[model samples]
Target: MIWEVFRQEKEGEYHTHCGNVHAPDREMAKQFAAIQHGRRKPTNNMWVVPKEEVGEVDGEKYSFGGTTDKSYRWATGYNVTADDASEVVESSDEQEDAERRRSEVV
Candidate 1:
């Protein structure tokens, strides 16, 4: 069986697909993933799943984003004073960056 591996570089970060391994069972797949992908890398977490269980749909079969200009729902649309809390500040910064990037793409 083939197993897909995903790795999280740090805490509170997203897990990205790393690589795959061929194993007989889930337990062995986990062990192989830990050694093959997580041994030298600065990985905080890892996930190994059977490749057959993963599914994907082509863009022709799915219309992902809606056809609405929903700029009002974004944080950049409002002019609120900044908060002193670190987490709130981080979130605001991320949202602002995303909005900026989206505007550039559009």
Candidate 2:
């Protein structure tokens, strides 16, 4: 059986897929993952999951971002006042331009 390994470098960081280990059971897989993946890096935590247990969702199967106007999440969507800093206004303008170009491409 094959087991997937994910390693987290720090306490608050995300665990990323590192490598795979060939083991007969979960406990042996964990041990093999520690010896193979953990020893090379500053691993704060590690997870060993069976390859058959992992699930995946692809873009062809589902749309990632919903078909809704979510402009409120962008800087350009906010109302700017005169009291706002010039840098803030500049950033909003740049974001607006970028958003426009991105929309055109999409």
Candidate 3:
């Protein structure tokens, strides 16, 4: 059986998929994943999941945030005057920058 390995380099960090291993069971899979994926990196944690148990969601087939208009949730959408508040102005600027970058990619 094939097992997918996810490695975390540090505590409080997200586990990202590193590679795969071939093993008959979960325990052996974990061992194989450690030897194959963990040794090359500064691994803080590892997760071995059976390949058959894994699932995927294609972005082309599904809308992850649903088909609702969520512009109201964005900092750019609010018509507030951030005259004296530096943090709010900074957040709005960041949001606008991100929106511009995403639009360029699309």
Report the C-alpha lDDT of model 3 over 1-106, residue by residue, as the tens digit. Answer: 9999999999999999998999999999999998999999899999999998899999989878778889998978777765757887899899999999999999
Off by over 4 Å in 1: 66-106
For candidate 1, lDDT tens digit of each residue in 1-106? 9999999999999999999999999899999999999987899999898998888988899888788888899977776664545688899899999999999999
**Global lDDT of each candidate:** 0.92, 0.95, 0.92
| Top-down lDDT ranking | 2, 3, 1
TM, every model? 0.60, 0.61, 0.59
Q: Determine which window of 10 residues in candidate 2 has minimal summed lDDT.
A: 80-89
Provide the RMSD of all predictions against the true structure, rounded to 1 decimal: 13.8, 12.6, 12.1
TM-score of 2: 0.61
Greater-lDDT candidate between 1 and 3:
3
Higher-scoring candidate on TM-score, 1 or 3: 1
- In the range 24-101, model 2's lDDT, one tens digit per residue, is 999999999999999999999999999999999999988898889999999899898777778888899999999999
